[model samples]
Target: MDSFLSALKISLWVATSSTLLVALFGLALAFVLARCNFRGKNIIDAVVTIPMVLPPTVVGYYLMVLLGREGIVGAPLYQLTGWSFLFTWQGAVIAAFIVSLPLMVRVARSAIESVDEDLIRVSYSLGKSKWETFVHVILPLARSGIMAGVVLAFARGLGEFGATLMIAGNIPGRTSTLSLSIYSAFQAGDDTRAGQLAWVLTGISVFVVYLAGKLSRSRWM
Candidate 1:
């Protein structure tokens, strides 16, 4: 019971944190992609989208190469601050953020793109700056879709398993999230525990999906 609770807590924390990051950066990236056309834009979009289609293990491998102690990014950071994300909850958050980012970006981009260009032009005609137009007009118009993207990203983060396991390992009360806990229990032949955890995760995922669908169909403006 304690382990279950710990896993639940960790999973929620990781998912929430990753989702917040996804919402901020994903929205910005989506806006840029929607409003701008630059050289290599397609390449950037493809890179962002690739993780969604790649196997989770492959993504994990990529993360490991980039974040391992001797890795290009990790080595310099470790030498400077003596901090590493390996075998830590922070690592889990990174894994979740990367894997879930595409969902947020894709959905938010579509939403921003769907906003009426006439409305944007009118805002500009009124001497509104691009920043002001985005904050006031664009965001309000795209609220529903952006919210849907957030929900989906949270769901994806909550269920992240392979990449998290590879980077964070399964340290109880530390990095062991619900999905990782399920894997641990099953590996230990604890069918009962695994089933319970699975059901809990399934229920949460179902609720998130339903909410996202509802938000996608809703329009406040």
Candidate 2:
């Protein structure tokens, strides 16, 4: 019971933090991609979407290269701040964020692109600043897709395993999330515990997906 609760707590913490982080930054990036056409935009878009298609282990490897102690970025940052994400809850969050970010960006970008250009033009003609127009015009119209993407990102974060395990080792009560815990339980021949956790995870996923469908339908209705 205690183990189950701890796994649940860690999963919720990592999922929630990753979801929030992805949503904020993802939406902003979506807006940029939707409205702008800078040089190498396609390359930037491709890079952002790579994790969605890449194997989890590959993504983990890339993350380790950039964030590990010997990594170029990680080496300097750790030396300067004495902070390291490896094998920590923050590492789990980073893993979740990277894997789920593409969903948020793609969905939000589609929504923003679908917004009626006429409305945007009208807003600009009214002397509204571009930022003001976006806040008042684009956001309201795209809220449903943004919300759906947020839900999807959260769900993706909750189910993350391979990348998370790479960065944050299975440390019970610290980084052993529900997905990791399930793997550990099965590996130890604790089939009963593994089954129980799997069912619980499945139920949560169903609930979130159902809630997302409702939110989407309500927005359209």
Candidate 3:
């Protein structure tokens, strides 16, 4: 139980912080995506969502290639900071955040697009700056949708498996998250540990589904 609790807490921490970062980046991207026109908007959209459509292992492999100490970006990044983002808790967070980013972006973009154009026009006519319009008129109206997106992102991040494994490996009490820990338990022929972890994950899944349903219902209302 203590092991379970420790893994759970660490997993939640990774999920929460990763989701926050994903939401922040996704929101910024969605804001521009919702309001601006550019030549590569479609390209950008596809790129942002590619992770969702790709197999988890494929994404993980890609992350491993790109983030490994000998890889392109990883080499310089490691040299500059003496930081190893490949096999650490931070790597797990990076994996989770990358995997969950699409969820937040898709939801936030949809929400921002749903905002009444007339309200934006009115604000513009009133000589309000774009930032002011976003702050006063757009954000408040879209908060619920964004919040739902955030929750979904966090849940998805918490459930991340393949990408995390490739990047962080399965080091108990360090890089291992709940999903990876569960996987390790099964691989080690420890059915009891796996079963316990499975129940915990199941509960988390059920709660996230319920929360998402509530958010959707409220949106309809």
Best-matching candidate per lDDT: 1
Candidate 3 ranges with C-alpha deviation above 4 Å: 219-221
Shift in Å, residue 25, candidate 1: 0.6
Residue range 1-221, candidate 1, lDDT tens digits? 89889999999999999999999999999999999999999999999999899999899888888998888798888899999989999999999999999999999999999999999999999999999999999999999999999999999999999999988999999999999989999999999999999999999999999999999999987
- Candidate 2, residues 1-221, lDDT tens digits: the string is 99999999999999999999999999998999999999998998998899999999999999899998878788898999998889999999999999999999998999899999999999999999999999999999888988988998999999999999998889999999999999999999999999999999999999988877776655551
- List clash counts for every candidate, in order: 0, 0, 0
Stronger candidate by lDDT (1 vs 2): 1
TM-score of 3: 0.94
**Shift of residue 145 alpha carbon in model 2, Å:** 0.5
TM-score of candidate 1 relative to the true fold: 0.98
Which one wins on TM-score? 1
TM-score of each: 0.98, 0.97, 0.94
lDDT of 3: 0.87
Q: What CA RMSD would candidate 1 show? A: 0.7
- lDDT of candidate 1 vs native? 0.96
RMSD of each: 0.7, 1.2, 1.7
* Per-candidate local distance difference test: 0.96, 0.93, 0.87
Using TM-score as the measure, name the better of candidate 1 and candidate 3. 1
